[model samples]
Target: MNKNEDSVKNSEFGFGESNDAYAKYFFGQSYLKRLASNSDEKINVSNVSFEPGCRNNWHEHSIAQILIAVAGEGWYQAEGQVAQKMLPGDVVIVPAHTKHWHGADKDSWFAHLAIMVGDAKTDWYESVDEAEYEKLN
Candidate 1:
């Protein structure tokens, strides 16, 4: 792992490894740590961490998704909406099928617990518009 990946892995959240499996869907480096999953219970939880300036592509879930910010700062923006700044303890409830994206701020690492309410499938769309993202603070 490179220096930045190593530092993110050792972040306060201490969640999963470098998220290479889904790297293609993200604009920059991100880590994934699966915290819980139960087929019978139909529940899934993961701690996702992003390096500074890292963000995922626009996507939507078949079911609602809940993101609880655990460390640093980030941005969450739904289609046609202004990006929302997120910090520790901030929560974002993303309605099912909403085109949106979330990731670390330009100068901060970000971590959040993603709780999947049920057996949700995600449909990833194009990357967030670069010009639009750069406009965010």
Candidate 2:
């Protein structure tokens, strides 16, 4: 088959169900499912785990991101805002350049699948302040 035809076929085709070893860590675990784009677009798919007392540094995105809670519970908050409690089946859409942080509760486990689009490099920032976090929870 020709290259163009192959491209169309591949796009039309789909990947069957699969999974990976959820990476374990103090903050929690993460499993990178796969890269979203086959050719050149910048898209990512990852399964993240936030253990009890685990959280991520407050950061902003060059593009947008989508977070889908697959299991457990957690919270998400954007810059200059209150945090929202999240549960299974919840979805969060974070706009570009909006600083935010998310993680599991102090005594609970949380897991979610996150997808990001745009420039792949993520700009990291300081960890969420304990005082500020307490206010949200």
Candidate 3:
């Protein structure tokens, strides 16, 4: 397979059907591959890909997170706020315990290097309401 194809295949990890009400119901064009696991480093590191309309539920970390978009376009939305468009080379730092959600836009594929500090906790909350998400588009 080509390098890009390999990358796509490698990005899938731990991600399965979304049980939450707001979880993306259709995989459609979206894709995710987990390139690395917690075994590879002191902290948890994941390579994730989001096809258009794919996104994580609202959540936060006990420790801060640093997201570096390696390819395509995406967006991040914090609780009670709007989402900001992200592009290649964009780096996002989410403070500890900050509620937010992020993923690829409705029309583009997005991938990022997800780095999470160790021993931290992730608190999942409600999905971003569609009305709120629509504002970002």
Candidate 4:
């Protein structure tokens, strides 16, 4: 494939190995690569990748969470709100204590860089049921 072809074909392919430690917090397949993060730091960054149809469970942060879409497409939704489609360059700021869930669209792999701030702690709730997620499509 030519460069352009390669890019287009893999637009929905996630990079990196599967992340295991936090797998329990998510649904389907996802991976994590920490870039600049420390337990003592007020802000940390990590790159996360999600397989097609994969997503994290509904959760809330103690302070704030920022998501920067880096590749493919996905969805982000807060409690009681319609799911927002996320594409490259899209940024979502999740304020402290607001319930939200994010992940790849049904046919696309998604990836993003997550900037975590404040206490960087999260409280996870229930998994997003397949039927509920499919509604956003």
Candidate 5:
């Protein structure tokens, strides 16, 4: 038997089934891989992937949320702020109750490891305006 077989096996790293429950909060498509969803554990985590031109609505968390960019490129922006480019190894710490949004760039597939601290409840809001999104340069 090959000892390296585990590493060689094909796997779905980022791409996965779409999460339809929050479909209304996103544009294009996105996938969710729940790594941890137990509140008793104190911290929850997930692996999220965004297709090109896909993004979630403006939202906020009750406590705080951290996103560790792990693959490709994407954009992150807080309310009334310029959109910031995010690449692998980038880390974003969103303060509690601050409205923000994140997703893949128009031409990139993006993935991130999301870590939520405390019992933060995500407050999702309105979708991004396409006209305004197009103006993002």
Candidate 6:
């Protein structure tokens, strides 16, 4: 099997079911597993997994969001900045309203813990341009 397939098969956090609800905002298949949620405490956390070449569209949160890379490899990029390669233990602190997109690398499965700092309302924008994404290693 290819690296992507192998990684998925041996994923650390179990890959949840297809993220159908947000499929429209992604390029390829993605999965979501809620790790924690407390309406009263306004806390939300989820484990998100991406298939090879999968990426979410450019988007931003009303409040700051945090991403902790938990498995395999991925890429994270904000508007007007170079994409950041993500590996296990890497942490990204995205400021509120920063237009950004993130997902698996072209040849690897990836997963991250998404922590919504507050009652964040995400606003999704256009998908990452294919030409631009293809430029990445």
Where's the lowest-lDDT run of ten residues in candidate 4?
1-10
TM-score computed on alpha carbons, candidate 5: 0.84
Best by lDDT: 6
Residue 38 deviation, candidate 2, in Å?
A: 3.7
lDDT of each: 0.88, 0.63, 0.67, 0.81, 0.78, 0.89
In candidate 3, position 30 carries an lDDT of 43
lDDT of 6: 0.89
lDDT of 6 by residue, 1-137 (tens): 55656555456666778999999999999999888899988999888999889999999999988999988789999899999999988999999999999999988888898998567799989999999888888
Native RMSD of candidate 5 (Å): 6.2
Residue 59 error, candidate 1, Å: 0.4
Please state the error at residue 86 of candidate 2 in Å: 0.9
The CA-based lDDT of model 1 is what? 0.88
TM-score of every candidate: 0.90, 0.71, 0.72, 0.86, 0.84, 0.94
lDDT (0-100) at residue 7 of candidate 5?
A: 21
In TM-score terms, which candidate is top?
A: 6
Candidate 2 lDDT over residue span 1-137, tens digit each: 32122222232222212223322212343323443553366667766655455677787778889998765667888988778887867999999888888876655566667788667555777777777666655
Tell me how far the alpha carbon of residue 25 in candidate 4 is from the true structure, in angstroms, after superposition: 1.6
Worst 10 residues of 6 by lDDT: 1-10
Model 1, span 19-59: residue lDDT tens: 99999999988989988889998999899999889999999
Error of 6 at 90 (Å): 0.6
Off by over 4 Å in 3: 1-32, 37-41
Decide which is better by lDDT, 1 or 2. Answer: 1
Tens-digit lDDT string for candidate 4 (6-69) = 3323444335567788799888888877777677767788778887788999999888889998
Q: Any runs in candidate 4 off by more than 4 Å, and if so which? A: 1-14
